[model samples]
Target chain A: MAFASALKCRECGREYPTDPLNVCEFCFGPLEVAYDYEAISRAISRERIQNGPLTMWRYQDLLPVDGDHAVDLQTGFTPLMKAPNLGRLLGLDHLYIKNDAVNPTNSFKDRVVSVASTKALEYEFKTLACASTGNLAGSVAAHAARAGMNAYIFIPADLERGKVVGAAIYGPTLVAINGSYDDVNRLCSELADTYPWAFVNINMRPYYAEGSKTLGYEVAEQLGWQAPAHCIVPSASGSMFTKIWKGLKEFEDLELIPKVHTHMHMTQAAGCAPIAEAYEAGVTRVRPVKPNSIAKSLAIGNPADGYYSLKTIQESDGDATIVPEDEVVAGIQMLAENEGIFTETAGGVVISGLKRLVERGAIKRDEVTVAYITGNGLKTLEAVEDTVRSVTIDPTTSSFEEQVLNA
Target chain B: MGVTVRIPAPLRRVTNDQDRVEVDAENLADMVDAMEEQFPGIKERLIDETGSLRHFVNIYVNGEDVQFLQGLETAIKASDEVSIVPAVAGG
Candidate 1:
């Protein structure tokens, strides 16, 4: 039931046949999966979708691969929490938190890697590879192991030790480049040219990125097949923000959701906010920065999808905001205190930007708003440990009592 | 027309890590051509073999994507700025 039709270039409107390719040969634009939407729309309905599995595979009809051999590790269908407490604290009335921090690898990247690996298996690729920051490295390694593919992942050497161990434990050939994530990505792009491996973010990216659309689908469905008034998403390469908007539009095209007004706001760490910097100055071009923030996961100084992401925000009449590093840590702690979501630094950027949006009177209090929390806090505990309070206690019963009853 | 072009971090290898470069051109395409003349090997880094801008790279003129405005044909004035940004795939 996979309704893939062709691979279309995002920059230029040229179309190519289905293949493990991500760029247009003619225009060099990024390629995306085109589908037989009319056929899919005729077959899938709200009832059909609701009756399906609780995971992202529920929309398998719209996805790229077929057969039961999906590289599924229970990736999607995460909770869409109604954050009245969080909303109240942020001075908003209707706020929803899409908590993807609980995924298998504690990041929403599990969703993309799961699909990419599955498609690679379908393509019979013997190797799985990607140029990652931190989260995708772990997710790709885990999925490649499950799919019986030889996984070779590359990341910046200074990545958090926790993330390094998290990926290494999965038994992948992890390469550490002593430079920025962009440097690692450049090397991988060169490697992809020579190696016969299925580089997830390079060749298999068209399908991999499609997995993010499920997040948008789930949000709309969870809200009764209606788009929210606004959405604030953290951006790294800027793919997630654009894909979420695409997901909402696809739902509307299929008549599964009503035509609704949803502004897509983008959030970034101030230390690495090239996209936000571009947007605030009313420019469409992003100026890459050397990422120097604790929010390492969001420290993509040269976002691949920066232009399109900025385009999406502007087209939707939305805005992009950059939160300072201190506020990013505070945002994580605040979300945990208000709604019990232990989010990572990127999530902190999102929450802090959401607050900024509200304070600026950009997002109205009564409007339905959703803030995307993409990763878990545990992986980034080092970033906020100094800022967060720790409970100190003694082993002795008397000391424990004294500490417990401190007045 | 003279415009200041900002070089992205990833492409700094070709530009000698100079964050910004100044060039003279009447349009986006002319500006890019001027950049290639000023900084050798940069066009290859920014554009593919097919002479199209790479998917990972974007050029902006005065804060607007050249793609949405005649792409390489986008007009540029003396006071306008051109920026070359590549996608950073870190997080």
Candidate 2:
């Protein structure tokens, strides 16, 4: 049973009916899914959650949607593996990789789209729409197809070819806007008001953003109810970073865990890291910049939740860092070589950010750290296209001996 | 001084479908007031009831964000080009 009472304004104290609304009409502040923790504390239990499906819905009471209209494609409940290889390399005792790269859409976006699509159905929206950098477009299209809803997915024109085909395969009306991710998002914000569609990250955002909490829940549960010492998450819109923090706090509030003192670390690619730039500059405001990065998935220049993300990072006493382009490539290669887990560019950012944090002594060597791997490498083969090409040899033993054994 | 504000498509309804409008105001807060006088519902869209500029709406003067300047109190000048760009988020 959903314990969600209403959608409450994040900036203002006003509450509104749970509807297909993103920002508050009165204050224009983002609306969030407000839940009754006291009621949830009583209604939910560990056994109850364990008995549910092996998907994100396992934490059903915590989610805002009803079970009846849940649009699911087996999203979430991904593996939380103890990365002994990566840990040893980083000189950390405990290192975990939240391998969400294996999701249905091969990205963490499936988690959010599942909830948003279901909530759209609940609200009787006929279409599922959104402006994406890449990952979200594919996820939205797939979810829309599953729900038999008309889908209109928009993206920046220069997105990865794989992501373009990924969404196109789902038969959504895909439109490529000739601008940055920020431009696409701006157009979607306007389109969301004009069209009667459920733009997952716009009109249906409150429900969509809540889906990220499952990542936190899964980590805690996988860790046997112990929160990690540090969680390094990549920031785009910065929603997931803050949501993970909220998730841990909620788990403790619901008595699922005794306590959580997790330091929320944020990762960003240097090319488009407005939040990190602000943090480094020691300013409370985020200044937007035009993005020029290979990590296209995490390139939301004017992040909607930048201010709040800054606050969450500061309040959690967390540290954030941005990885250079070369380090991003190395991070992906390091993970693939060390743990056999191939990840997208955004995952590389997380790994590299963790590396920088460790080197700078911001993230300690002894602390238990979980770096969120947000997407699969296959979705962004272009990023590693030139880096890891196989050596060509003649089909003969002599050729192999000369190219490999002799070398 | 008179300045031209390029309103985004979302807020054009309040401006009677005019994409750009020239308003005489000394500062951003005064510009908001002047725009509200011309378009009654524009202030509610741009600012919260508490009167602070909405976080999602970014106001820029001559290509520089007002936030880096003096925010709503940033002074204006004649021929200054003001643009109201909404924050782009997702992905």
Candidate 3:
């Protein structure tokens, strides 16, 4: 049975029956799935969760779906690695890495797309659609293919070729908008109004967003059912930051863990850091900016969830910071060199922001901190190409050793 | 709080997809409340029931986020501009 109670407007407190709707008709507010938490609390147990699938569906009881229609891409259950070497390099004692680069799409978006596609199937929609930056497009296409649905994905025109190809490989209808992600999103919003397709982040947003909670759930579980003292997450729209906090709170509410004291830190690229700007200015509302960061994955000029990120960070006693482009590149190199992790530009922003926070004495070095790496470096190679050195040598042992190894 | 507010595509349904709207308010809170009254349920998508803004919705007054001003209580003037932006993740 689906544990979902109803769809409730986040602003007006008005509730509606569960359906494929994302916005409220009366108030124009975004709709979220309300659940019978009492029932979920009673049914979901640690033993039960352990026995379930290793993927995100393991917590199906807490999810929105009701049948075998969950679009599964084997997402979630990723590694929460102890970054001993990386931490030591940064002068920290305890640090962890929620490495989502290993996800099927090489990003954390797979987690949300899985849930979105599953809900689309449950809604009996034959076509899947979304307006993505890059990661979500690939994830939606991949999951739509897995679910045997026709996919129509939209993205910005200038996205990385790798991501474009990745989405196209899934045999989806890929459309490139000439403007920024905001323009693509605007077009998708119009399409959502006229078309019956399931735009995951549009009409299926309530469920689509729930997938991110799995990231938080996995981190706590991997940490042996304990919330970290602090979590530094790269924020674009700010959804991931809030969802992680929600996931931890849900665990605490379920008695799966003790009271959650995890302070959430929001990181951003300085070129497009409206949220961080607001945070530093001691504000709650974020003004949109024109994004100009190499970390395009996290370059939402107008973050939908920017306010919440600031609130979460401030309420948790955590802070938000934006890293300059040079620092972002340095951060990417630092992670690659110290932890053997090739993170994308967003990760660079995160790592650099963590360093800034540490330097400002905002984050205690001794605290058990978890830095989330959301995407793989291969997706954003252009950002670090300048710093990544390559040695050209003939196919000879001596030449290879002299040019590459000895260099 | 009397300023013109711009709404993005994702939130157009709440605001008739109209690119912008004029509302009367003194701060982000009043603007949101005013927008909610004019658009109904819109404030919820932008703010939670407890009056706190949602995580994915960003509200800026005159290209300045209220988070740095007075948060919800940031005072606004008729000459200011407000824009509601959601985090667009698809690239």
Candidate 4:
């Protein structure tokens, strides 16, 4: 049985039944899935989770879905390895990388889409739709294909070619709008009212967002049932950043962990860093900006959870950093060269923001820090296409040595 | 044809369950005023105390956001279709 009890409004503290509703009718605030923790505490344990499935469904007790026949694709339980090479270079001792890029769809969006798709089926919805920047489009389409549902994926027209092809490969009805991600989201909101399809990120968001807590669950469990000292995550809509922290705290509340003092740091590209800018200005109001960044995946200017993310950062005593557009490529190169992990622009923002935080003394040298790498580099080849250098030589030993080796 | 304003589901209660209302107004500001005059308490929800559009409320004129146009002063023709949509939480 699912432990989720109600969908509660984040702002007005209003509660409603666990339906496919994201926004509160009265306050217009986001509705979050509120679980029956007392029952979950009795049902879940370390031994139970360890004995569960190897995928994200292992934390099914904490998630909002009933995991009878989930829309699984071997999504989560990604590697959490110590990054000594990256750590030593960044002047740190205890540094690890939560490599979520190795997921089925090559991004962390799979986790949420997996849960959302399962919930959509439970609600008897035939169509799965979403307004994606890039990664989510691919994830939602893949899940819809697995569930045998019709998929309608919408995105900004100028998205990455790899991401567009990635979603299209699943045979979803991909619509590319000639505007920004925010514009596409607004249009989808209107469409959600007219259609009976389940928009994963819109109508099904209350349950969709609960899937991110598995990241936190895995991190703590992989670390021998203890929360790390610091967690640096990439922020777009700020949902994942806040949910990761929420996962850690939920474990603490359930007596699964002693206590979580993890500092949640958020990173963003300078071109579209509204949450980071709000945190920097010591305010709760996030002023939206026109996105102009190479990190198109993290280019949501008007973030929905910007206010709550700021509140999470302040509550956790965490910091937010913005990476310059030029340094984004450098950050990607840094991780690739140092740790042999080729990550996309969002990961680059995390690594670059990590450097800034370390340089500014916000993160101590010996603290346990886990840097989240959310996407694979293959999807964003254009961001680092200029860094490629190839030599043209004939099939001769002498020509190879002279052109490639000597040069 | 007149300026037809489409009310979102949340604000339909104030409009007496009327999904669409025909209002005679020149611009967005006058439209909000007319809506308040008809609905009695909707202006406070659409516009904040500072007299600016609330952050969570979006006003679209013929599928174009008013923020992209002249905002409150955006001229409205008689045949325009206005929609008041609530901002969605991100994906």
In the range A1-407, model 2's lDDT, one tens digit per residue, is 36899999887768998877666655567889898888888888989989989989899899999865688999999999889998888888889999999999999999999999999998899999999989999999999999999999999999889999999999999999988887787667657756789989987888899999999999998899878989999999899999999999899888898788899999899899998898889887678778999999999878888988999888789977988977898999989999999999999999888888888887777788999998999889899999875778999999999998897
* Rank order (by lDDT, best first): 4, 2, 1, 3
Clashing pairs in 2: none
Superposed on all Cα atoms, model 1 deviates from the true structure by an RMSD in Å of: 7.7
Pick the winner on TM-score between candidates 1 and 4. Answer: 4
Error of 2 at A90 (Å): 1.0
Off by over 4 Å in 4: B13-19, B26-30, B40-55, B62-80
Instruction: DockQ for every model, please.
Output: 0.17, 0.39, 0.18, 0.48
Encode model 3's per-residue lDDT on B1-91: one tens digit a residue. Answer: 3598777655677678787889888778888888888888776667666777665554566555555567778888899877665533333
TM-score of 3: 0.84
Clashes of each: 7, 0, 31, 0
- Each candidate: RMSD: 7.7, 3.4, 5.8, 2.0
Error of 3 at B7 (Å): 11
Residue-level lDDT of model 1, residues A236-336, one tens digit each, is 88999999999999999999998958999999988889899999898875767778988888877678888899889977888899898789988998999
Could you give the CAPRI-style class of model 4?
Answer: acceptable
TM-score of chain A of 1: 0.97
Displacement of the residue A384 alpha carbon in candidate 4, Å = 0.4
Query: Which candidate gets the maximum TM-score versus the true structure?
Result: 4
Candidate with maximal lDDT: 4
Evaluate residue A356 in candidate 2 and report its C-alpha lDDT on the 0 to 100 scale: 84
Tens digits of per-residue lDDT for model 3, A43-83? 99899999988888887887788535677778889888889
Candidate 1, residue A222: the lDDT equals 97
Over B1-91, each residue of candidate 2 has an lDDT whose tens digit, in order, gives 4799987655776788897899999999999999999999889889866777777787878766677689899999888989886664477
